[model samples]
Target: MRLISSSISLATAAALLSACATLPQGTSRDSTNTGLDVRTRYVGLTSDAEVAEILASPLGEEAAVRLALFNDHTLRARYDQLAITEADLRATGLLPVSDGARTPEAGIALPVLDIFLIPLRNKQGITIPERIEIEVTDHAVALIADVRRAWTRLAVAKQAHNLAKMSENIARAAEKVAVELADKGNLPADELVARKIAVANAEHAVIMAESERREAREDLAGLLGVDLMGDWFVHNADPATIPADLNAVDMQAVMDNSLALASSKAEVARVGASHGITDISSILPDIDLAVSAERDDHQWEVGPSIEMPVPVFNFDGPKREKAEADVRAAQYEYAHSLVVTANRAALLVRERDAAHKLVKLLNEQVTVAADQAVAASLRQYNAMQTGVFGLLAIRENAVEARRHQLQGWQRYRNAEVAVDAARAGVILPLKN
Candidate 1:
């Protein structure tokens, strides 16, 4: 049996598919770099220099984003995925017969049987560009989000850990004074005990913060598709001072950029557009029309035939139902992404705003007051107006205030990352 569409040959389809193996538009080196930043791709630097450049200068948030876009293994995988989607699209356009690759239809019958068979009707599906558009957008957004999220996590953890080190140093200094006073019989038993406890607590906090920092770095490594064995320094930015104008957030634009909802919409479009031609064995299902030639006992006859199914009990009922169900499922997912993600982005913005306010309060009032109190206590202790234990106690309160400030900053950064992810499902123009 020889079955094929009459319009396109197998070689032509393979050539077309081969020509499209490169990365899709947005995910290409240029487009991806453009989305992350304004600078053009680094053409002059060798790979080592590029790594040195990222490590040499304190890698800021934007730079880290660029680094992820350029170097992350998963981002490369996404580009590979686009090629795969193109391959699938080309596969659909090839001859409908499964054996099109090994054996081409030439109207030749088997020599042993001396008979020829050919499909009367054959139809080919041409892929619409919109079928793969959503995937391209979604993958680009995912790359951007993952890179920033990991970078922010690592940066925030480093900030908290640095503060923890400061607190630990202060606590250790206080413990040294307490031990001296206790040995000289100048400190009370309870005061010495409290000083020791504070020292132990501060040490534990530093240990925990260090662990948190390492975990954050590991997360970044996972995003970059690398192991965390090498020394990597992340440049930290004070996010509390970074101006993110809430009023500037384009809610409508963000919604429009959403790749998730767009993907769902594309799904509905794909299913609907393909409904007419999906089933191959139906006359009404974009009937496969074919021409056949046969020789019957030295009589040559040429005829046109259609490989259509009679409208019996199963007249594309299951296929139509399946397509409808797919549309419904996609619609639900889009609705959830729209309503839930939009609200979620709004809530995160609110949290970031609230955290900013708290950071302001801690920076201006609570931390300032704690610093003054500690300074006053230090002076009093020098003049014998306050005991060493009293100074240590005030220092503990000061450390606690600073810890709160660190928390506020971390919360603000985390909220910023979340908002970026929320903004992803919406489509952004990929400037080529």
Candidate 2:
């Protein structure tokens, strides 16, 4: 009788403990423990009014990322997955309730094996939420990279447009000089026409540059989840500088903070726990403690009863086999993630260094040679050793070199951004 009372007390204690247990919040802001690459400054933002306020000011890279993180509906939905996991976890703690009025005899049945399996079940329950949190972190990190890439594109577009406008002005000035030479009978008619053609080409380049700038602005606005109809302004900040040393990036930090690996590890833990629970339950018999009270022949009969099923017919072979298979699959997945992450980091670093070298070559050798050639051609034209056509050709070559240099700088900046993104455990797709 005392043992029956003890068993009933234990069951009551478990119910009370479940009622008191605190569950994780449903929102990513509270539930996500994995650190983001950028500090989430505006977490749990409630309204579009905050987005409007940020947009009303000059929008910077960080501000754009914050708005996207706050406003992305998909990311918020992913966070909401935790609520379902929490519900399942809560169900694990509650005992089955039976109708009390159906029978005059009443009993409380407790699964004795659950006392040993509950911890493993709870641990398995925890891994699912952890995996969800890691997935949320991955999405946030990827979104940050997308915002930064769009920001860089906008900055480079502005820069390229300004350069094109300046080149157009220089072309007009040269056309004026050719007009003067034509009036003095020193320049041929064809040479003057050539100068006009050069001016026309420069004007065309400016138009193209302006179109590209507008497109970049639209792309940025799309990523920010804001309509392009507003008077919101994006600040024309210079793109990030090329990284001087790829060696400075900490590979260990990449390994430690990788969202993909973390998620896989959580999966492994979940399945491993499941396998343990299944294996243990299969080997041991089901032992249930039942306390009953009954009235028979006008007398009260009360006692404690033990109900256990023998394992003669079924040893849970199918369940144990499935659990073991699941554990093996998870372990394999974790190993694959580990290898992929290491190789990806190495590849990004190599590509970044290569981009840096290309930019440096363009800046030092290509642009410098074009400038030197133009200077020599100008001196020759002044000394009557070369025609105005030769001078124009040299100047055009210099303009083309400058355009290439600008593109090279943009690519280098993007490469640097890619390395930074990979360090945060997300890879940005290669942009054309």
Look at candidate 1 and tell me the lDDT of residue 283.
Answer: 20
Off-target runs (Cα >4 Å) in candidate 1 are 1-46, 81-132, 225-227, 237-240, 274-337, 426-432
Total residue pair clashes for candidate 1? 9
What C-alpha lDDT do the candidate models reach, one value each?
A: 0.53, 0.58
Candidate 2 wrong stretches, greater than 4 Å: 1-50, 83-128, 179-193, 237-247, 265-335, 358-402
TM-score per candidate, in order?
Answer: 0.63, 0.60
Tens-digit lDDT track for model 2 on 119-191? 2112121234455555654565567677777887887788788878878877888899899999999989998
**Candidate whose lDDT is highest:** 2
Cα lDDT for residue 58, candidate 1:
66
Residue 374 local lDDT, model 2: 94
Q: How many residue pairs clash in each candidate?
A: 9, 0
lDDT of the structure predicted as candidate 2? 0.58
RMSD in angstroms, all models? 19.3, 19.6
Highest TM-score: give the candidate number. Answer: 1
